[model samples]
Target: MVETGTGTLPTYTETLPRIPESARTARRLVDLALTVWDMNEVRDAAEMVVSELLANAVHHARCESVRLTVTRLSDSRVQVSVVDRSRAHPRRRAAGSMEESGRGLGIVNALAHGRWGVDSLAWGKRVWADLEVTSGE
Candidate 1:
């Protein structure tokens, strides 16, 4: 079972298969949540953040499925998280220009403005990033 963060704020979540195609579903989830919250300004960054997080879980986690969550942390911020049955924490690595991979976390970090981290669960881990909607949005 997934906790919806005390049920205080609006949230969207779905359990997705551990496949590449699920990333698209996760992105749509984020888009939907942000749209409903009237936070479209951060929709693009939130979508990209969720995509990277979901891609990492799909490619690296040894599980049948994963849980994706999008929670409104505040009026100006939202949290995107991916939970998988893998305890191994994600690592950020340097990728060369010619490399086609190893840049997922880098993109998450940039888009989230360093407001991202992983939480260890008894069954797995939750990787999350916070996207803030700037003023005048």
Candidate 2:
């Protein structure tokens, strides 16, 4: 089940199929949440990070289910996380030009602004990125 905070800040989460479509679904969810929170300023970066995270989960996690979560930590900060039923940790690879893959983590790192990480869970692992929301957002 998904969890949402009742006081001050709110969190939204959902479990999705570990299929290719989930990546798109993740973007839609992030867009909707940012819209509702009046955080559209960070929408582009958030969506890009979410796409990379979800794509990584679907392609590398080797699990049947994935959980996507968006948390509003404060008025100026938000976090997006993906949990997969795989224990394997992901590493960033050095990809050359014309390489179609192996740059998911790199993208996240570049866009997350030094605020992304992986946490080992009892059943699997959760990868998350923290983005700074603009005040006027």
Candidate 3:
């Protein structure tokens, strides 16, 4: 993979309050970034991934704010990550068919084609997902 600062892979970041209402805003941010980066190919999946990650941060991370980062890695790959002020990392577990929750990471894994993981930050942790950029119909 090429380095991010070669001017080919544009990036965007936004720090938002950790509130339930911020989830919608986060999705909109992803959509807008994808549009700006001309990576609309993966907008839907990227939006879903952002929403899930942001929602998890808001609901689980007992922090004041979170940062959302979106990077266009290439013509066909983009990475979305969320950083929060909590060390608690997310885990994937088998979700029962009838379960109403506990499936955010699962959805991310499926959408990202198993290209996702979490990293610990100085103050918290960041969860990221890399998804294929395709102009889906």
For model 3, state the Cα shift of residue 11 in Å: 1.1
Question: Which digits, one per residue and each the tens of the lDDT, describe model 1 over residues 14-76?
Answer: 899999999888888888888888999999898889889988998889999999999998999
Off by over 4 Å in 2: 1-3, 7-9, 135-137
Candidate RMSDs in Å, in order, are: 2.2, 2.1, 3.8
For every model shown, what is its TM-score relative to the native structure?
A: 0.93, 0.91, 0.88
Worst 10 residues of 2 by lDDT: 1-10
Best by TM-score: 1
Which parts of model 3 have CA positions greater than 4 angstroms off?
A: 1-8, 135-137
Q: Report clash pairs, candidate 3.
A: none
lDDT of 2 at 67: 93
Candidate 2 residues 17-112, lDDT tens each? 999888888898998888878878889999999999888888978778899999988777889999998999889999999999998899899877
Per-residue lDDT of model 3, residues 8-96, tens digit only: 56777788999988888888878887787777778888988999999899889997899988887877788999999889889998989
Rank by lDDT (best first) = 1, 2, 3
State which candidate, 1 or 2, has the greater lDDT. Answer: 1
After superposing candidate 1 on the true structure, give the runs of residues whose Cα lies further than 4 Å from its correct spot: 1-7
lDDT of each: 0.90, 0.87, 0.85
Which candidate number maximizes lDDT? Answer: 1
